[model samples]
Target chain A: MPSTAEPDALSAGAKRGRPGYDQDSVLNVAVQVFNKHGYDATSMGLLAENLGISKSAIYHHVPSKGDLLRLALDQALVPLEAISEHERARTGTAEERLEFFLRSTIRVLIERQPYVTLLLRLRGNTEIERTALERRRAVDRKVADLVVEAQREGTLREDIDPRTTTRLLFGTINSMVEWFRPDGPAGAQQVEDNAITMMLDGLHTRNL
Target chain B: MPSTAEPDALSAGAKRGRPGYDQDSVLNVAVQVFNKHGYDATSMGLLAENLGISKSAIYHHVPSKGDLLRLALDQALVPLEAISEHERARTGTAEERLEFFLRSTIRVLIERQPYVTLLLRLRGNTEIERTALERRRAVDRKVADLVVEAQREGTLREDIDPRTTTRLLFGTINSMVEWFRPDGPAGAQQVEDNAITMMLDGLHTRNL
Candidate 1:
């Protein structure tokens, strides 16, 4: 519920991120708080109080709290869902496709850093969260299969299990969400190039 | 909190894992639940119910919920702290030390998977958690310094910033918690070896 002492600034009916209590504005705030407090730890009262609106106002935009979670989950996974459609991810040589997928993934993560980080932090407390986690694993399995194919082609090494390799590669990539800063030392492109190099070439200086 | 239905399964003095609500038993159950549900989402009532003990009984051992968190955080970091003092990690060349740190970290992670995973999942919901996060970052920074040392000695590549390199290295290692089953197809030694190889040699068939 809106506090009676709501700031003087907000009394004039400041513009909602849209004309009404739009899903986008609500999501922007929800993601921030949910990211801060684990999803289940957050409460409708908290969201309403933060929005300086009654719980009914948020209800006006979305049916329940779960709806906001679903939208945030979508914000994180939808781009990767498009990854399989990328020409390179679809029909390019296994390594080429893997490269495209890696490069494209980094771009998506940086662009949607907050949502992606929120996605990683989710503990599957609810069906929506669990589904997001499952969808993430599915995307990983798809990438693992490509790693297996590349290994079959003798491009990527098979010494590690395809699943293991995929996990490690992703582990490295996903960790970026924890620390990657757009305004920090490296630009997204720089981080992308370095990551691809580390994954493909590794840390040590190579000698043929 | 013992139910009247406290099955004949638990005899009167069979005891709740030790004597009158031992911290160890309480912790063993607490860590499991904390790992399942992020810390902030978990509560004293839930922990008590799961342990099948009265809340006051648990309170008999640990003073507060934060104490349990501190214990779990210790479980995850203490081993790595020991690793830093290992001969190889301490006195070896930068590259050698980095390698030792990586291998040791993977071993420790596998050995302490659940708590370590919980440690990583924590978003510093409390001051104790934030301190844990800071300590973990401090460890990463020390490792990053080693990486910079290696680069200076021309043993490792320098194109990427050392901090990024450190995060990537950790991201890869920390990911082991996500899917590595100790009893899975690849044993810990096998996974560790493959990870080291990949880090040293890379994924593709090299043609340097």
Candidate 2:
């Protein structure tokens, strides 16, 4: 039942005898293993083996596998939720605000690719996964609302259904987890720019 | 050792105790189970239980679980590969050809959603999975080549990298597997039209 607190404080009070391990480090390794082997398939023993630490030592950091999943999911979800509430996203013209949301989302996905990948893949098999899905859906609804607003204001195209547009827009962004490499030839800035341009401007050459 | 031939003939010739099943029926159920439980985690025993038949009956239809996966993946990949080879996808301007590929792909996905879902989720853990992935990648490369051709022809906006554009383009279409229900309120034609408009026309209101 270790709580999320300062790494030093939590580690200093640890009684399980594993030194040099913090919750953050443990969570990072856990997310990697979960991504490598799916969440349900990964057991604490496998996680400990991968961490090169005893199961008890791992428990000293987090209580159960669910806690590790929650922490890992939050790594991706928190920043995403922030974008929806940000002043820029809230106050600008619906079009500008939606663009801000998209840009920020792409950045978060690029920076936290593994976490977001795990987040996107959740099939809601467990209570914890279902809760995570609820949070994810809430974020999606907020973005879709922006699309609706933009469409209402006539700044965005009105022909397409807002919900479908939102899904496709986010789908394009989420699919990056499948193949986008942070260290690859395409940089994050390039991806962000290209996504905004392609999404906001038609891919077809304009007469302008 | 049930070859995929006439379902009736295969079922009639089966020496196994169970008489009702065919390779196609078994494959349909196996794919459903595979989609429910992941490919690696699903055992022959589990598939048999879901099929309400004996393990031997299951084996009579397909030699092994890998065979089931191969068959299921083919259900999706074959038609997709066909689209690339289709005359409409080959003869038109690059933009027109790419549009045909996109529309055809959306149709295939909607028609064979369960198979496509399993195919898209493959992680290449087995030889069969790896081969399916290679084929999928080849199809992806062909689509990307279309994008490149469109760009070279100046029909598509050249500012974005063709590879990135291709990924984002197909990414939008492939993302449909996530939530696009063929049975839902939105018909396949509507989803197809929205996706094409969103990808090609941009979401912004046109000045003209």
Candidate 3:
């Protein structure tokens, strides 16, 4: 995934006197606006006004508002799909692999929060959204599979159903998007560690 | 709180030749449409169309779409506020009280899933939304206080920050709105039990 922070090399090279915004920068602003206003309520005019660029300038980057939506959704989904298919996520002991998956998913959520937030709120009103939802479900199923494997391996508790375990675990992690600020009083590392400990060790004080 | 399943007695009594809907039923359909299409995007025409009633019929129930928004939001918020202020929630040991809060919260979220879903998705774009957001924050602070008391009483582990713990615990519980079907294989009782066990006991197998 291209970092929104870096200049878009391809766009920069292709256009002479390109508007001050690159595709990544436009996407960054678009995701922010989509998040602030409901996606269905956002228009290209509103997006351009927020971008401080002409409608034609935005068109220079992407063909339509739908294209921006697709790009923005990919920003969140691609990394998550990568995590599910990562060699380490695939090869480790189920317990080890599950931890890696949880930790990695948290990092992705924090890094791509705006994108992920938009992705989560999607209602599948369009074909692009439905396709994105499918990819998201596929990732969810992979994580659930890991939970099942962990339970079967006896490294994790078997009392709780694995699918329920996956849902609760991801639910806890995803809830962070509501209030977690990368620059908040709690650093990302602290938030991640606290979640891991709470998930693995439970919140009760151990007698031993 | 009046159950949506029950007819709206006041509205039923007030009107002659009342449309086939009551206030609770109108609010119920309004909340569903809002959840599906979003609060801002939904208009009275769309709502009336979905409800198979005239726009006048919807207006008979509520003065304006904004009124419906406030009413729908309150349907979710009022119950949550009551939970925080419930006598049992206030009287028990912090650990026991916290458990009650969690269990009661899960029950409310399930019973009022659509309303709560609408509440959670509020963007605070209007005065009513901002007010609802404030009420939500207040409830969160109360829950966090219970966590602080639990940790101080040596029931909950001290390593995690009480506020973060509260957020994660509620985050885990609040997440049930996403995919937890009341009619699904897992009953509400099972979901409540699994969440309580996961939150209090951790998910790892006990070695002792």
Candidate 4:
């Protein structure tokens, strides 16, 4: 009888069948298709067609659609997770810590663009999606806790609720997925810098 | 051969045992159902079942799923259209006018919460969605223009691009649809006030 790890063994065993089609290649294609057609709307047939491969051939790499989603979300989750544990994020003044987290989060989104796009779009209709959502929200809560602490230290404005501030702060960053084309004039670093500047200084000039 | 102008005639000619239901009530039910299950995933059968009406009765109010989508998009578009023509939106200092436009836009969103939720969730896969998205982008351009004017006038910071600022500003407001529960402690006004404060004051506190 095959063990529970048999699927992984089977997927890894086929190292040369598809010629340059590894787990990463499959995931790249799957994430693109998922972003375009939506996770629920995408079918294995459509995915196979997009990959220019047969259904069984595609199955050799990933177990199912949900596994691809898991892989995609994990790639996006790592950067934000890193920020929570990073030394700079932990050992700075409230303002500096908050800034580090924000800049790091944006850098992660830029680096893992497609994965984070898929991560932000998950609607929780599937167990994989719900788990991804919970993990992302935990990341958000960690940042929100930092912001709340910043507010308590009289660094951030006290009028707005910390939760709302967190949403607005991340909302500005998340909406970039919808409009921020990679081929634009501004590079990712510039985008991150400008976003941090806006969050920190706002639109109005400091004098007025 | 009754004219479509006659609401009573439309109601009477509606194919159902219950003659009281109009297009408005059926649309209300359809929007609610659509919000729960998404526009593409929702079936006419499910909407009819939820409405306690027959498929033909549902069809009498709207020709197809696209028609219902058009109606929902119209609700969101109407407010923006109004804001464009608003006198205050045209005449104030760029920052003040933009604030007025944003505050009004938020009020409209809260008032038309469900329809706006549907509009915001739309992906431009279909002609109807594409047109709605184009109009949304046009409204964004108008706001971006205001930001640019403010920058020129030395009211707003010059470092950030006006277009990115507009996206983040509107994105922050639009995200209210995702987490906001009307049943929560903060009502729409409170939310608006906080959003205004955040947009104007930002997350960081200044000595001034």
Q: In terms of TM-score, which candidate is strongest?
A: 2
Give a tens-digit lDDT track for model 4, residues A1-208.
1011122333533456555466876787888889888888889999888777788987888888888889878889877687888899889688788898888898888888888999998889888888888989898987888888988888887778777778778887887887777788777877887788777767788534
Question: Ten residues in a row with the worst lDDT in model 3 chain B?
Answer: B1-10
Q: Which stretches of candidate 3 lie over 4 Å from their true place?
A: A1-16, B1-16
- Candidate 2 lDDT at A4 equals 20
- Model 4 lDDT tens row, B1-208: 1121234435644455446467666666677888888888789888877777688877877899889888878888988778979899988798889889889988988888888888898877899999999998888888888889989988888878776778778878898877677788788888888787777656677723
Interface RMSD, every prediction, one decimal place: 1.9, 1.5, 1.7, 1.9
Worst 10 residues of 2 chain B by lDDT: B1-10
The per-prediction tally of clashing pairs is: 0, 0, 0, 0
Of the true interface contacts, what fraction does each candidate have?
0.74, 0.74, 0.68, 0.53
How far residue B123's Cα lies from its native spot in candidate 4, in Å, is: 2.3
Chain A TM-score values for every predicted structure, listed in order: 0.87, 0.90, 0.92, 0.89
Instruction: Write the residue-wise lDDT of candidate 2 on B15-85 in tens digits.
Output: 35455566677887788888888898899999878777789877777788888899999999999999977
Considering only N, C-alpha and C atoms within 3 Å, which residue pairs clash in candidate 1? none
Candidate 2 backbone collisions, by pair:
none
- Candidate 3, what DockQ? 0.62
* All candidates: CA RMSD (Å): 5.2, 4.3, 3.5, 6.0
Candidate 1 runs further than 4 Å off: A1-21, B1-23
lDDT for A3 in candidate 4 is 19
